[model samples]
Target: MKICFAVFSFLFFSSTSVFAEESVGISVTATVEGHSYSSGGGGAPVPVPVVSYVSFSGYAYPAAKVYIESDSQNVASLSAGVDGLFSYEVYGITAGVHDFSIYAQDLNGNYSQSVSFFVDVPSSAITNVSNVFVPPTISVDKAEYGIKDEIKFSGYSMPNSSVYVVVNSTDGSLKSFSKEVKSDRNGYFEYAPIANVFNYGAYLVTARTLYGGVFSSFGSSMDFQIMGRTSLFASRPRCSIKSDLNRDCKVNILDFFVELRWYKKPLNKEAKKRFDFNDDGQVDLADFSIMAFYWSR
Candidate 1:
């Protein structure tokens, strides 16, 4: 029995490896071998089909990379569409209760906490797992801060939603603080400390977004240390305004030119995430006029 098990393991490990395609927002496929009947194996064994069709669909940060894992092994990796939506069909899975985990990394390089679940798949059966929302991509601008310096917390989540930022002292040298920040129409959010509300110590920060009055799970935790004497200068929040396209923190001619590329054009969900200022599903004079309001801001 032990020799048979060893031989089986060797055969499995020595098989060809498959890789995911380098494509954005597409289904992932792989090949796996199924068991077949052998006439000279001492006895006739029943054949079992290994094919299982399962699809996973969900939302994450815009243009983010979504990864899928099963039993500590990588299954598939794909990018979310511009609209923050992603779906992938996994092929060559065996029929069983398979454990799976999903996570995403936003365009800003922030990685959200993973969402895990299991699926009871039958041979030749089709199953779909949808509405799997990846948690907010979270980050801190810096890993160390002065006592009086503003700690900027930023991330991406559902557009037009409310983000809850939580700050707590990991070493108990400071009090826990939390507040609600608003996500912009494009799902980017940031909160920079405006007052000298911190002490000398190590702190942890986390964030989550509320969609339709429902809050999502808290994402991965980030920590920072406040060392040495404090600085008297208070850090000001950057111009993270929604209309600042080029991210130069200013709405000027450069931003205008970027927006004009989609001028008067029918906008898709991804395009609307950045250009659809009015949420009318179209980019026209109305959207451009709104951009005019923030010009030079």
Candidate 2:
């Protein structure tokens, strides 16, 4: 690309000599006036309306020949080579703040001043908004009485500023338990609800900007649920030496002798329930046989 630029420059300068018999030469120079934006009339900081300049006699160019451009593709532009004045409106531009520069090239390949403007698009209905990230459904600790349920809430913001979340019940009632969060430099945010509050139930969560005037319409909503905890010991009875159906203290084939001896006796229902190690729910020959099958291993 550099080589192409060099070749193009060489051809362009050589061609200018034919237009002016006095061995003419063309070069580019530009200045972005003030090098920054001004809050016009002290009302509120608006986007710099235009980049203005005066050109010295270098090359006679047609007014319809030059074009003005901005670094950002979305920024608007206009060209007037007649008086070297440029005015443009950056349409659908985002709110909060922005920075951009403007430059133009003459018909004869001479560039004018490059003026950079720092713009504060400010909050308004016409301002553009964007949401860069929407956090995934975060897992909350299953609810156990007296234990806190904690889950993080996060997402990104454009023209990043304060963010708000509305925690709602499954029935669509607005929660008094809502909170606000701030976005990071990279548009990241983290929020953990207070402990001992949320219970096991479905929830609907929605997001919005605190400065809604600028970013109200850019956010989305999500849903999540906190479920009840299951006890590990609830589904099975405690094991014991005598309860070893196979007569192995570790519960193998050796315990089968004791089980066979007391098979007809009044067996503990809990022991019988747990002794169904084969998981068929019947404390019988099959359970004993399975224990014997894996006894040594």
Candidate 3:
């Protein structure tokens, strides 16, 4: 399979490239900006009402419906291409700090999480928003599973991309399973795990997509209880495991290597906060031991 990167359309006019960084649904990426006045504005220009524009380019499921709203009002929408790339320009936008919310829905009815962020629009200027990533949506077949029941999961990611599904127990037993599956041509994927979820009081399942060079954070989690042919009410929230430094829902060699880089080395504030698993203001053997305990192997 061939991987494609997003291609941006550069404007004809010369402008200063003043770049800034902002995070989308999952992780941080380039949100570059080419500062320039509106098409109607001249060297010394006046504020033109409804003359500013905002251009957005990002990735979503191929042929998916991408929608955007400004300050809770539907402003624009576009469809992603076959490579899951989408570029849209919203014209006549009044300049100011606007709250823009974006999301995507694939043809198979998978809906990504709504990502909301603030954009400061310069008067009569063009604001460009780039590197937006739409997260994959996930759902399960049932809310309750019997001991012998098979676990089924379905979601939509970028076409031909890999979907990682993870299951963890919250009744405190730490029984878990993690697997990766590929999406079909339409970015639709389904998985039925072979692992038996034994002795589970409650389990939390979530999914994320890895496409091209990027992946998203796990979407809405599904909570199901292991009942003995009887319906029961049981649910409690499970926060992300701190030991999983990479946030891939597993503490394996990938995580081990991530923490290993800082072993015994002076940690930056961010590294100390994340890699210092023991919270003792140091990255030592104890931190690695904690990661080993939550290895999820």
State which candidate has the highest lDDT.
1
Backbone atom clashes (below 3 Å) for every candidate: 0, 15, 0
Best by TM-score: 3
Give residue 226's error in model 2 in angstroms. 1.9
The TM-score measured for candidate 3 stands at: 0.58
Cα error of candidate 3 at position 38, Å: 13
Each model's TM-score, in the order given?
Answer: 0.57, 0.29, 0.58
Model 1 Cα RMSD, 1 decimal? 18.4
lDDT of 3 at 119: 77
In order, candidate lDDTs are 0.71, 0.42, 0.70
- What TM-score does prediction 1 earn? 0.57
Of 2 and 3, the candidate ranking higher by TM-score: 3
lDDT of 1 at 273: 93
Query: Which pairs clash in the backbone of model 3?
Result: none
Residues 156-257, candidate 2, lDDT per residue (tens digit)? 432245666666766655364566777544334557774346666556555544432333322323445554544333221223223455443344335666
Cα lDDT tens digits for candidate 3, 127-213? 778777777777766667666667678887778998888878876587567789999987888887632545547787777777665
